[model samples]
Target chain A: MVTMRDVAREAGVSKATVSYVVSGSSLISEKTAAKVRAAMEKLGYSVNHTARALSTAKTNAIGVVTSFRNNGACFDLSAGAYLYGIAAAARRHGYDTMLLTGDDGVEAIRSAALSRRVDGVVVLDVLIGDARVGALKESGIPAVMLGSPADSQGVDVVDSNFEAAAVSLVERLYDHGHRSILFIGWPEAVYERKLNYAVRFRASLMEACAMRGLRVGAVYAHDATLGASEVIPRALRDCPSATAMVIHNDAAVVGAPQAFERTGIRVPADLSVVTVMPDQLGEGMQIPFDSVGIDVDAVASHTVDRLVERIGDPEMSARVELLDQPMHVRGSVRAAHED
Target chain B: MVTMRDVAREAGVSKATVSYVVSGSSLISEKTAAKVRAAMEKLGYSVNHTARALSTAKTNAIGVVTSFRNNGACFDLSAGAYLYGIAAAARRHGYDTMLLTGDDGVEAIRSAALSRRVDGVVVLDVLIGDARVGALKESGIPAVMLGSPADSQGVDVVDSNFEAAAVSLVERLYDHGHRSILFIGWPEAVYERKLNYAVRFRASLMEACAMRGLRVGAVYAHDATLGASEVIPRALRDCPSATAMVIHNDAAVVGAPQAFERTGIRVPADLSVVTVMPDQLGEGMQIPFDSVGIDVDAVASHTVDRLVERIGDPEMSARVELLDQPMHVRGSVRAAHED
Candidate 1:
């Protein structure tokens, strides 16, 4: 196998120069860097990551605890996209991700935490009182969650402002002359579990309706996508007075418009629709729905920053960061009828 | 720090008994197992995974390398589903999954492979003559790839029979009285990168056409989802003699029928369309085209099996496995002259 010595010999440079080029520490001339790269490629030299990590005590890897198993269901596309975003951001920061799933409730988290397999962890689909957070804290493993803040001390959290985003969607509908609007959301079991964001969404929508004196028609979807078809029709049938709808689920937002079209309902003409989660609904899918847009990239980048901070300074106090969600009006929503 | 001692104390048993119960090494009474589980849960005691792995040199974590970074650039739904399947299978076998992207490349694969971070890796979206493969092999790491047999050496591979599937699709079209059929595929750069699947697909279709003494029309999709507005009209104008279309791209199949509809052409009646990829097109999409079905579950399960085998016995010779693709005749393809 080609090593640093081989590259150094091929480049006619000292072994230290080759090491400096590979480590990317200290200044090296661009000319020398190119020479080193060419020589390394020619010699088929690849880094010995195990030896490197052992020597440096830095694998440049971030453990990602995807807690879908504890949540007892598959994460929908939007959730999956959020994870992909986190992984992408970690990669940009010169870190790779290690995924932890059902092992969240057991020794899995602690083992990964203590083994120094990762510099820190980016926890996804986190529950409000996740045990892994406690385990990570006890093990002194720096951690950040992509969902609602866990109460564990010293853990950093980056999450969307679910309550604020939901309220903004409701307020946008009101501003658009919508007096009677329907709120399509995830199941009640999700909220009952105190999954902070889900509960917050429900509370914010209800509070927004009460403050505005608007007739809020709320329907809890059975599952993410399948329920959209069933619940939308029932919401329309039960409350024929509703002129607009706000969806918090991504799958439902993508599927609802098609469901409405199948039922011969023209969007914004017969009924208007809007979504709070917009990342997974691609323009190519052609749903054309308006949205309360949470910048997925922002959330991902912020989470990486927080995790990196915690990794560097594990003794820092627990911090919670909430990103703002902006509203993007598209073709699916319109002014409500004023008779 | 609840440990085996705590479980033993609570369960009124010895530490070895607790160990046996936790590891399931020896057959223990169900009543004793329940007692240990209850005691462990009550005392918040979980196994010490780090110590165990240090002694055994095994971490029940597998790495999944995917193309999440190239999301919109490629229709990665099939790839995503395959990763999900690997995760599910890993869980069933008492393992967790770690996700690694291309950004980290050799370092990530090597660290995850050798530092006992992951027991094995399932490499997806592998290019022909990949450097990562060579790196993994050099490090004596167990690995599997989701690509063709040609690209792999002494490494297990799980892939679809792209050439045979494409030929079968062409044969179906010919059987339906279509003399001229156009094959829309991924960009030529993908083929040039020696992905070879697309190249094989085209070759098979050409061979099939030659066997039937017919000339097959073909087009290269600039993107995964061929926008019918651009490609379909161009195909029609360029090959007006063509009566049928076969799409290997998933997203293109979703939109091709709509492009035909917009041009006042009926599906199967005006232009018959068949896709090589079958997921994502079956339901809830605008264009429901016929397909040469690729079994996503089979691909996922078989890859997992190979990965597990490689992890268990790293010195075993690598093998390639290909799953069968069946044809699903939907409304998109029909007897061509019937229109």
Candidate 2:
């Protein structure tokens, strides 16, 4: 409750001098500034963030709108990692995050935006032609999408290029003499939702296979763990002739090696597996599986940069950024032979 | 901006009636309330959260202090799950969460608390004689600790009963005819830091073993995953007579089954493993290991309840709450000797 006037009176200085010292707006003598700071500290004076935000029209808070629908039921590893990245970035920039979960409807988004609870919004799992994006644009609020919709307009997007990454994995399999490859993707990404990058990756894989005269077998897994016990066996049984498999899930990859062991299949000899998500495969949890390491740290850094940029200049033109995927060839893939 | 005056004029009602309609206080006639709502909607009038918060002196925002030091690492599954539970609970209560991470020292906590950035804080991994706890209490801020410290002077705590849970598991193992068991725990929890519930569980296991005239072998794991790979093999080799293992780490349990497999040890036949964690394990990433499920949801709900109570009545005395740990028997532990 100590005001600038109290600090000035205690320090025998003018209120303007106290304000300057506290705000660091102007140069003040070191001794005077110290005196004011000591007096303010002694009086238990703290900056009122709410009042400061109201006066400056800057909340220094970012709104994170996350959907628990679609693949949101999956473990918090993926989405949580992105959020952790954003939070870390925001902290570095002296900002805080306010999470808005399960805000599906357009009205909900508009309400959140108009309420002025946050200065900007970082949206995850944004569908093509998302209502939230439209609402944010209409309300003149800065918005950044974790993934872009098919017809992106008036929104900045920062997402991993899963489709291209999938294609690259398939090409690697093809180059290694894999004539037929099995593709395991998440179910929600393939069936119920359109925001899934795994589904797009599957389509791109099939397209690339068609152009190269290759056969691609696909299956939808409810999750990575389930995929390990259920889908991997089915993939092997249905595509016995297939020599390699491409996985777009980290959880699935972790269980795939065990699945192979259960079926008495030797990795890189009888079958091969690769994953599109690399961060989930932590340093010590390596599965000897070849992978296109999706640099999660880089993805996080880029998303933070994009969200900050959008926040700083809400009127700036919307943009879609696609980062390149790097491949880490471990011992999972091998050359297929014709018997 | 359409104020209450505008709604009153458009709806042909008094300003007090419009205010009553918006605040839902002193209920107006249904017809009059509907008319006021319609007029406000037509004029695009919305309640400003900032102004409302100022008037009510309630931000409806909870602060969650999570450290990323040692066991508080970002990728720690249990820590992440705990945070997720808190966030989900806050969302269900129509509240937003503001996470404050990396606030290690007293100064950081003091800044966060005195700034009034959040209504209350949910503190995780609280240490014995923690400086942050003292600072928070001194600031008269509402807080709930995920784990109970040995000393609880001015804070509410919600934690699992580790000793009883460990004893129950030991008894179960004894009933299954296992004479010797190996207990693996986190090194940081046991040595570097003072005794926590995990350490207490180890002590109870030792006491139970002593009571049964059997010596239990124990080892400290650097982390769950590391212990899974390194400790499992060592336990088998070093304590060749041991037939069962109780693991407290979730990540380590994920690989424990695999580690046993690598050593050509059959579960239940060569060794039995039981972990202590939540039953949900994490959606989509379920490990097949048997476990004693800690009611994490209950813990989270109770913590929130206690925090709200403390916030509403600051004069209420602080207390320690220890909840029972639910045992979830899975396929890991079996009869030591097949009848």
> Would you estimate the TM-scores of all the predictions?
0.75, 0.92
Q: Write the per-residue lDDT of candidate 2 for residues A69-133, one digit (tens) a residue.
A: 32534654456566667777777777787777654645556766777778877787766556676
Which structure among the candidates has the greatest TM-score? 2
Q: What is each model's TM-score for chain A? A: 0.84, 0.92
Q: How close is candidate 1 to the true structure, as a TM-score?
A: 0.75
Top DockQ prediction, candidate number: 2
lDDT per residue as tens, model 1, A1-339:
466788899999998899899889989999999999999888767765545665576767787776553232323445545667777888788786766655444465676665566778887767777776777678777788777744745577788888788787888788888888888877666665666677677788889888999898888776443446567888888998999988776556655754574466778898878787744345434446787776777888899988887778767788888787777777777788886
Give the RMSD in angstroms, all C-alphas superposed, for model 2. 2.9
Query: Which candidate has the top score in lDDT?
Result: 2
Q: What does DockQ come to for candidate 2?
A: 0.47
Candidate 1 structure quality by residue, lDDT tens digits, B1-339: 566887899999999999898889899999999999899889867665555554566767788876434433553445445655677788778776777765656776765654456788887767666777787787677888877635575778888888788778888888888888787776555666656466667777889889997666677656554354468778887998788888766556655644564566777677888888744333423236677776765777788888898888877877877666777666777887743
Worst 10 residues of 2 chain A by lDDT: A68-77
Q: Which residue runs of candidate 2 sit more than 4 Å off their true CA positions?
A: A12-17, A27-32, A69-73, A103-108, A188-190, A223-227, A278-280, B1-19, B27-35, B69-74, B103-105, B187-197, B220-223
Docking category of candidate 1: incorrect
True contacts kept of each: 0.15, 0.36
Model 1 chain B lDDT-worst window of ten: B278-287
In angstroms, give how far residue B182 of model 2 lies from its true place: 1.5
